[model samples]
Target: MTEPVAYSTVWHVVSIAIVFLLGLFFCVLIGRKIGIGFRFSVFLYLYHSFWCLVYFWYAGMHGSDAFAYYNQGLLGIDRIWFGSHAIVIVVSFLTSVFSLSYLGVFLFFNFLGAVGYLFFYSSLRCASIGSKKWVNYLIFSVLLLPSVSFWSSALGKDAISFLAVNLALWSALDFSRRMSLMYLAILLMLVVRPHMAGLLVMSLSVALFFDSRAGTLRKVFLGAVFTLGAVFLVPFALDYAGVKGGANIDSVMDFIDKRQSITKGESSVDISSMSFPVKLLSYAFRPMIFEATSVFGLAASFDNLILMFLFIYGICLGFWRKLNPEYGNIIFIVFYLFGAWAVLALTTTNLGIALRQKWMFSPFLIYLCLSYINQRQLGRLK
Candidate 1:
């Protein structure tokens, strides 16, 4: 008899990476041409935000991650000795304002999701895609997909990560000042989702390596790799050290860990015994799409996985062209996206869903790469 679908389909994740690459390449090209301004950039992103709002509503209809947003913020404030970023603070306050009702919080979360995308689009404008006219409208398709909308502004980890991504992408494209908004955003990510944060940090650093002005010693292309390793180790180190921490993190970790095991064909372990800290990390860094969304009874798609890999390869090919031919942001986007996805793919199969949380700013990333690619065909006079 043949093996199960999961075993036979292990190769699907590779495909996901490739699709992400192709999408990114086109994004970079578009970003460079549109450039940053009040006109084209704002209109496009606003359109995206509008669709994203509709998507959030769709998720509500099906009852998706809405509960997650409502519940996570409560977990945040209910715990002590844990410091949240500016957005988290707002979420915590809203949770209290809503008196812990899931429905009320869901509405608030979707509102923030729309606002988060606004910042994300503005950040992309700061980067500048280059080409324009009708092509700009074409990019809004990112938000037009039923699935994309269903999840776009809905509550949960996706919204949290999108806020961080918005700030990061904006900074990646903006002023050269060390204190840029992106630096703060990256710093916040350190505490939030360290692994993916590190992933993007490393990826962008690689992109910066191609920037000519970035310099080897000062910027550290290897930071993201090291950061990812550290993210895994940091919790255990802290827990072992007897440092004061949250009440829920440990309990949550225990429940999730016990429930989440490498064991195949067996039912999940007890959620109560699993460690809360581990669960927090799992929700934040766990790579298997099926495992993470298993709570929703959502199934995996072999085809989506294939698309991701194709996307990565397309971006990588752009890099092959840029690193040698033009040495622009195209190479940076290619390097960062490939590294982020490649590293995550190695870590686990869950990356398909988890990556979505962080890649909300992917629209911006696509533009960043495309902008640089477009820049290649034009240069200074001899």
Candidate 2:
């Protein structure tokens, strides 16, 4: 039995290399088309790969759900209809078909994230909405974000969700193709995290409604339709989140409070007992420079600080007004970030969950900041 496992492990190593190399080559091709430059794309691929390897290595040594997911796949497609089981079942299928090891499964998901990011950036370029320099900088910054890189480079639902969300953005904005990608994205989110799908639609709808350049009647009609959809959708989403019946504001709040209490005793950091403002602060900006107790914590804190500074600088430079444009892609990002944070802050209790979930919103948050910086530069040039 051990011999069989060891043999499979060797094959898994080979498979990982093949998949990674192929992905790297594909990324280089896509990068050139998107004007990302061969060198930069290669750099990002290597950087993200390093983090992924580190994640897998750490997991292997310390033990993690990687093995659980790998093993679950061996059981052959249980709970296929359940969104949470989707990744596990798919990974199992791939592992069996390819004779993959635990490492192989992890590497494959990392590859998905890397490639997903490429298409995501490509869509932004396709939109032709922001300054090239600014967009490029934001992409680099988001890739460098410790939480974004680490959480998204692992083999888990977070990695898959991250890829799906980015792809959704790309498909929604790219415009070259039909809306198939957008629908696919919605389906993926609904399966994995139903609330996220709701937030995605709500944010996009609200942004469109508020666009000053769109016709009044068009905006009103769109707003009404989206609003009705949300009214029906929210309760369904709440049910999926395990909020019990009716899924109203009060029930959601009750769920949050109950979740906070339940997770408070876990080994992770517990801000459940903190004041609401403090809890929100912790969610948005915690593990401050001085508060960091570990290397990872410090890195996360540094990323948060950098983001906070950029936001402040943009405001001080009077770029906030331009950032909140009446028309353009930035508004979509702004609304999405706002919607995601609102939901995450209220419902999230554990620091670990907060870190991983908030990363889903960082790409847009970073983009908005970069957009402001670009506007400031353009204003100066004028």
Candidate 3:
């Protein structure tokens, strides 16, 4: 009986691989339809596939919450609306119906994620920055980042969130699109992470109201106001209402301080006492080469270094000064990145959690840098 079970598992894996290849082929075709050339699409499919494999191995070697999710799926659905329980039920149902091993489920969602990226890539065509040849390369680089691709290719809420967010962005940004897809994306986000869904809506609303092409002085004032209000006001409001188990402002700050203290021993930097800039840097660029204790950390550090360089380069290129809000994409990215960063920097105490949480916003970060270069070159031509 044990031998039969083992053979069944092996058969399941083999079949899943074949199905994944077929799915990837269809995704490549979709990519081709979206002007992503057959070769590039194939490359992306392969690249995303490779990382999905790595994510699976990493989840098994390291500790992952995927097993808990998987076990929850197996235990049957409870019609519960509380705290990711709905997602567990859906995942459980899918795995059960399809007879998916955890690895198979990982591959499947990663495939969905890859498809979502293609849709995201298509939506970029509507943005001012998407026409440049180098922008293509930069976007491809963002797609391959380990934090974006690897951590998001697993079998947990992160993978699902990544896909849902990408699809949502695509639907929201499409120039002449319908609302159905956007609504679906929002529903998925609500089921998985309602707070993030709210944040996304808030960011979009702010972006819609503040056009970037208005006066630079106006943009600066409004941007600063929005940033400060979001960073301080939302947390206080949530805490005051005791929403989502939130505590008062002091309690929240103390909680973050205590968390930093507790996790300082586990490859974490002590950032509790640091100023806001230092805390943000700790979130964005820590685990530097010298500080990395593992191979994964080293890889992450390299990406951090690249981001640092890009930030410096963008500043030198006057990217921040020349932000064009004529396009809706710029507005959305600006709001999303600032809002996400502000909240994360204030609340995140652990470096690892910081890294994972920030992956949701990395594409926009990369796009902001590339868009600066694109706009600068266009200005020269003008």
Q: What is the number of backbone collisions in each predicted candidate, taken in the order shown? A: 71, 1, 1
List model 3 lDDT by residue over 176-236, tens digit each. 3534665566556656666565576667546635653447776676557656655664564
**Reference-based lDDT, each prediction:** 0.44, 0.69, 0.65
Question: Per-residue lDDT of 165-213 in model 1, one digit per residue for the tens?
Answer: 6666555553364225656665555544554555555555555545556
Which regions in candidate 2 have their CA more than 4 angstroms from the true location?
A: 1-10, 119-142, 169-180, 212-233, 265-267, 317-320, 324-327, 380-382
lDDT of 3: 0.65
Least well predicted 10-residue stretch by lDDT in candidate 2: 1-10
In lDDT terms, which candidate is top?
A: 2
lDDT of 1 at 332: 38
Instruction: Give the backbone clash total of model 3.
Output: 1
Instruction: Report the Cα lDDT for residue 95, model 2.
Output: 70
Clashing pairs in 2: 73-92
By lDDT, rank the candidates, best first. Answer: 2, 3, 1
The stretch of ten residues in a row with the least summed lDDT in candidate 3 is 1-10
TM-score of predicted structure 3: 0.79
- Decide which is better by lDDT, 1 or 2: 2
- Residue 209 of model 2 has an lDDT of 79
